[model samples]
Target chain A: MKRVEFFVAVLILAVCAGALWLSRPVAAAEPPNTPRAASDSNDGALFTAFVPVLRHPRCMNCHSKGDYPRQGDDSHRHTMDIRRGPAGFGVTAAKCSTCHQDHNLGNVHLPPGAPAWHLPSPSMPMIWEGLTDAQLCQSLKDPKQNQGRNLDQLVEHLTEDKLVAWGWNPGPGRTPVPIPHDEFSAKVKVWQAAGAPCPSR
Target chain B: MIGFSVNGKRVDLDVDPSTPLLWVIREQLSLTGTKYGCGMAQCGACTVHINGEAVRSCVAPVSRAEGKSITTIEGLSPDLSHPLQRAWLEEDVPQCGYCQSGQLMSAAVLLREKPAPTDEDIDEAMTGNICRCGTYPRIRRAIHRAAEMVAKGGAR
Candidate 1:
């Protein structure tokens, strides 16, 4: 009877240990992308490092706060005097793809083009301008605001979206995001591994 | 070989598929009424109709436009008598006249959608087109007058 009791106690301890192991940092995490539900990791610093990239004109120009998008490094109001029409693209007459072709043209100062170039659709504006780091982080994690994406989807988008990739190579005469593409993506992953924490501010 | 219908006429052209339709319309076909303002989609100056919807042809690729029916300012009327055109003249809606073609093209779509467009509808429809002269009030009046003409029988 004592032997059976001892065995049962051993089983309970083994189960507890297994659970604790599953709960540790991602270094031991299987499947690689496992994000902790919560942690004390320097999530604030990771996210703060990403803030400037978000604020960069290549990213922020499309994520405008107002109905119309801002333009250039100076963030001047779009000289075309256009607005975000029924869709984020311009109205019936001047759709976004009209000038922004699938790829950039040779004219350095002319329009910057990319595949399917246009602002976020009206349904998912994803406006990042004027958002506090905490709000921005929360917005990214929130499925409603982040195009119904969970953490995995967000990571995938940051890593692979063609339009987002435009930041690294923003055509001629455009200052791109400061961070290298791989580094930026790596930073995002590190932040995710840090349990995707947010800044208090 | 690329083929598209312009103003109800089938046009066949030998050109790079990636070339912009605006250049085709202006340079190759020699239909120059559609003006290029910013050469970006922001200005409605290059606005034209594609399958009854307004589209800026400035950056629209010739390949994507293949097999689609295109309408330009020239297609609006042979006689310069489309109701919107007549109303534009009646309201004196131009100052420098660079953006007038795009304005008329955009306004045509609005009148079709909302025959009796209110100020709000006008604002929404015509917002894409810009006149450096700041002739918005006149454009609004022209749209109203054009709507009235359409309701009467077909804007003449």
Candidate 2:
């Protein structure tokens, strides 16, 4: 009976040690790229870093809900009465490509341009103009609203998509997104690493 | 060399792809009918047809025209007999005559898309072309007259 009790105690000690080892930081056990689960204390703050980027004129000009895109720092209606057309580009003679080119023109007040310059298609406007930070975060995470992007894709788009990158180098005279591109990209990665948490409000 | 057909003639040029198609058509191809009004494309004076679609050439890169067919005002008709041109003459549409080529080019596509364009269609289609001479009323009248000519098949 004494020997059996001793074996049972040893077994319990072994199990407790295993539990302690498993409770340590997951970084030691997982692959380098595996995203950590959301840390309750940090996720909210991580999402806050993205708010200014989402609201910048450079990002909102094309992401608003409307048949026409706004232009300039003033967010005025585009001159020449341009329409969003069947595609996001303007209709007929007033198409986006009619004026915009693959890159910015050398002069200020000239048409600021980039490749495939257009608004989100009418079917999927992805409007961000009036959304609260919480709502925007939820919308971004929702696959239906986010064009079916998973967290990895969301990170990739925020970090590397050319159109999104345009918010950084938006021509002469245009104010770029408030955050530096690399900083914004790092925040996005960190947020993704924290399971892409959203603010409560 | 970048190759494309302009007004039914195939030509190749060793120009930078970023050069505006307007300069290519004007300086290299020597097809000056497509006038340059606003180099920013705010005005439609540089309108031309790329693969039958009306395009503003002033802002369009030569790279965008690669392997495409370009139609200038000169190609509207070999003998200035396109319906829009005929209507413009009949209705007396030119004032300064500088904006007429671009206006005609834009109108041709409008008519092609809307065989019998209504007043609203005309307003929508021709809105991009600007005429500082205030010939809008006459331009509208000419588009209507051209639509009628098209309906009757009286002129090609």
Candidate 3:
């Protein structure tokens, strides 16, 4: 009876240990080419940090799939008959930069702008319309689909990309992303350096 | 502040009380189709049905619409399959489309009250809705088509 009880206790301890191990967060692997600047082991932490910015109105509106982009925090379709063109700039007659200047126009009911005031190119849309974080992470890593960018290129894109920086300064009447652009860029670098491992959905 | 039935659901909102019902409906309730154009109410971009009457929402205050049944574009139909919507699509009466929501809301009230509104009646009822797309002819045709559809029992 004493030996049986001891075995039962050992089995319970083993099960608890296994459960704890499974519950612990898995660290992301570092990519071979990941820049020294972006090295970090916390893949899950990186995704959690980016959730709000990825889902912000400013980012989601232009990253929409349909021809017409959404507007405002409500995510309604654009008022005008705006269409994304073959080049994804905008309709031929009404290019995106026509109303959206190099910087935000500071108008209440006009097109907001950024230095590169255009949609993602059709060839490599980098579509984020309805992507889950895991899907987005996987999609971002594909060089062919993500504008032929490697992990290093992606790090550079996030850190120095003009449009990505716009989330911090989305103009009047727009809500900015939760994190500062510099902080977000730093996180991206960290995630890339950690091997750009996708968090389990 | 006002109390009204929206899409058959009762709602009460506290606002400027004298502020235009349009602002209350949009800013407070987050129903955005009812637009703001020429806040003086000269343009019917903010048209909505108040107690079955087509009222210009931009000028009508919350106090005025109090205890009334107010219906905005979102309340028209869940999927936008209203007869007016079908007719508008058939006639393609949209350019910038900034004004179509108001136009449709106004037409909805008109059609509900007068199932077979005459051209003269339509002109009198719809004169307020200004289409910047120069779709006046198309608007007239769609209204008539909607009426015909209603007459044929095809309206949902």
Candidate 4:
């Protein structure tokens, strides 16, 4: 009975040793601290960089849910009987191109223009008017709400779309988006690379 | 070069496309009846007909007039014989006469669309055109008179 017990103990010791050896390579292959830990620190700051640009009147003017797009930094209702036609362009005779051209007019107080100048279509107004930073972040990341764009496409649109770029060069007398386009683009990429994490607040 | 007809006259010019149709009509074509009250299109003093649609020419780029027929206030009548024009004179619609051309042009479209326009239709159509002289009441009366003439088949 003593000899049988010794054999059993030896077998158990061998099994334990085999399990440790098998796990050794996996432990070495993994990073010292997961990339998630390092990126968690930066994701919030990276996304925060986008807040000011998104909240600026230039961006918010057409992003609201109102049937008519707002104008000026004051965010007043657009005059001229403009209504968001089935599409974002104004209704009937008050179409956006009726005043706004492909480029800004030479003088101040005139309609600032861009290609496809319009508000978000009524079906998906993509309203950011009253959203908190956290809500904005979540809505932006949600494909269902963001015009069916994934993270990379969202980055491309916010960074490269001509209409979006108009926020930076919003004609004469208008204050532009807070961050420079290049820096904003970089921050967006960083946020994307970090898995597009949402902030708590 | 952009090509379009202004008041039944074919015009093909090499002006910058971004030039406002108001400038093209007033300066280039030498039709000055359409006054420029507000360049921002807020006030409809520069109203004109683009293919029979009343569009504010001050904010409408000439490119928008490309391939379209443009009718300025000058084209409304040869000798001020249009129904709206006669009605304007009959009702003394012009106080300052600055916004009259735009008012007449806008009224013409409204009359065409609604031969017998109520006060509400006139108000809805002519609201964009502003007359600083406070001649709205007179303008409304003139539109009703013009509508009556059209309904009677008295004027083309």
Candidate 5:
């Protein structure tokens, strides 16, 4: 009976060791020219950096739940009765690009622009109206939801994408994003280098 | 300087405080209903009640509202059960609703001052509130409907 009890104790010890090993956090592999840190790869810090940009009025207005984009910081419905078209452009004759140009036209109070001025396609609306930070980070990491982009592609999108860069240069009468685009891109790089882990909701 | 009761809270502030009171209310106090449209005050999108009179908020400096009772849309009724709101719902006077808050505020003042306002009275009072959707006819109708509702003691 004593021998049997000793064997059971040994078995439990081995199981505990295995569980601890498996539960240990894994570090993300760093890319070329990227800084390496164990905590940087963790999902929480990365998500914290990403949330502010997502919540900005410029980002939230077009990515709203309703068909119409809101105006001003107040998030009121669009004044001109504009509706998102079937293609996520404007309605029949009023394509968004008509007023929203390939680039910002320097109008202080009008729609600030980028080459891709319209909302995300209806097929992939990428709704950002009221998403929590965790949900947004998780959604962004998922290729199926992120317009088929992997972590590396997402990094490139943030660093090099024209629309993403617009936050820093949003025309007059608008509050520019709190963080500089270059710093934001560096944060994205750190996150991707850290295995693109999403925080647990 | 001006002293006024805003949203039932009395306060005093300097006039020409950089931006308009619409921006001040939205950016400072976070009361965002009064929109900024045609900042030159031609659009009437920033109407607020000043001592039972409809005044354009975009152009009405803090000095002008001093020592007066100023009310915004949020103060119309805590639950939006104001007569103008009921009339608006009955008539569906909003298309985009960006301009409705100002419109409702203006109509509320008109009804209070001229309980039995005519088309002419409404036109004269409502001239400042501009509806970009061209819902003028509907707005006119709702104001009259609200007047009738008030007469029957059904409006609050």
Candidate 6:
């Protein structure tokens, strides 16, 4: 009887040990700390550097939701009944090229111009009006939302697009972006290099 | 010399190109119909048609209008018979009548584009032009009336 009791105790001990072994691996496979640590520290820092520049009026004015791109720092509705026609330029009689010249008017208060003097074509407005930092970061990373741009392509656009460069050289009576263009480009590079993380909130 | 066409007449002005078109229209040529409410482009009171499209003449430099065709409120019709003007009268669209010219100039553009514009379209096009007396309801009704006149093919 004593020997039988001893065997039963050993069997119970073996079952308990097996349960412990199976549960241990599951926690190891998805350690909760890993993502929290990565998002809170590394990616969060990268997103911190990106949100302000994207939110600046220079970017927000054109990246808005409506059919018409805003004008001026106040983001006032563009006068002249200008709508972001199919191609983001004005409609037939009111095309952007009607007045916006190839270069900034040296004279103050004239409509500032660029080679392709139009808003981001209505097709891909890339609205960033009121998004939280996290949402905007996520949207930027998504190819579907970022105009099919990968990180490298986005970097090229931010650094080389002439219209975007106009933010730095916005003509007279307007303030340029606060961060130097080069510095702004550099921040983008760092964020992209670090895998473009979105912030917690 | 800044040369341009106004109301089908070609004219050249020796004024500085930096001069606002409002000055050239109101002071130089004396087309006083294009009222100047704000020196800035905020008020659409100085609205005019540059190549048949509404533009705020107050902030638009004379140089930009140098070669363009400009149409002022006074040019819409010799005797105020343009469909929009006729509708304005029928609907009693003016209160103080200060902003009527600019409102008509903008409404004309809308009629040309969408002769049968819905209420939303009118709201979209006319929001920039402000009427101090708040004659928006009358203006909106007038726009609808104008659209009907044009669609009836008797607008002229």
Scored by DockQ, the top model is 2
Alpha-carbon local distance difference test for all models: 0.81, 0.83, 0.72, 0.82, 0.71, 0.79
Q: Give candidate 5 regions above 4 Å deviation.
A: A1-43, B1-156
- The native-contact fractions of the candidates, in order shown, are 0.39, 0.35, 0.00, 0.24, 0.00, 0.02
**Per-model i-RMS:** 3.3, 2.0, 14.6, 3.3, 14.1, 4.5
Candidate scoring better on lDDT of 1 and 3:
1
Residues A33-87 of candidate 3 have per-residue lDDT tens digits of 4554322535466656666777788788878777666788888876554556567
Query: Which residues of candidate 2, in runs, are more than 4 Å off?
Result: A1-34, A38-43, B114-121, B148-156
Pairwise lDDT winner, candidates 4 and 5 = 4
lDDT of 6 by residue, A10-103 (tens): 9999999988877863223433223333344464775676567777787788887788878888988777567887777766335565456556
lDDT of 2 by residue, B96-127 (tens): 99998999988988888788888877876777
lDDT of 3 by residue, B1-156 (tens): 468787678888766766777888888888888899977545678877766656667756577666778888888878868889889999988889998887887777667767887775566556656787888888889988998998998878
Local accuracy of candidate 6 as per-residue lDDT tens digits, B39-147: 6555578888988888778777788787889999989988989999999999988888888898898898888988798887787677677888999999999999999
| TM-score, chain B, each candidate | 0.96, 0.98, 0.92, 0.98, 0.88, 0.98
Put the candidates in TM-score order, highest first: 2, 1, 4, 6, 3, 5
Cand. 5 TM to true fold? 0.47
| Tens-digit per-residue lDDT, A1-201, candidate 5 | 999999999999999999987885332333434545635544577657666877888778777898766777777886655566577775422345433534553446645667777777777777876677778887777788778998778778767988878877878787776777766776677676656656666
Top candidate on TM-score is 2
What does each candidate score in C-alpha RMSD? 8.0, 7.1, 17.7, 10.6, 17.8, 14.3
Candidate 4, residues B11-72: lDDT per residue as tens digits?
99999988889999989999999999978877888989889888889988899899999998
* Candidate 6, position B37, lDDT: 91
Candidate 5 local lDDT, B1-156, one digit each (tens): 556688999776654643455766777667888888776445667777667666556654455455778788888988978878888999988999988888887788668767888886677566656787999999999999989998999977
- Segments of candidate 4 deviating more than 4 angstroms: A1-43, A79-82, A142-144, A148-153, B16-18, B49-54, B59-64, B74-94, B104-127, B137-156
Instruction: Pull out the clashing pairs in model 2.
Output: none
DockQ of the candidate models in sequence: 0.27, 0.36, 0.02, 0.22, 0.02, 0.07
Candidate 4 vs candidate 6: which has greater DockQ? 4
At residue B29, give the lDDT of candidate 2. Answer: 88
What is the CA-based DockQ of model 5? 0.02
Model 1 ranges off by over 4 Å: A1-37, A121-124, B36-45, B77-81, B92-99, B113-137, B151-156
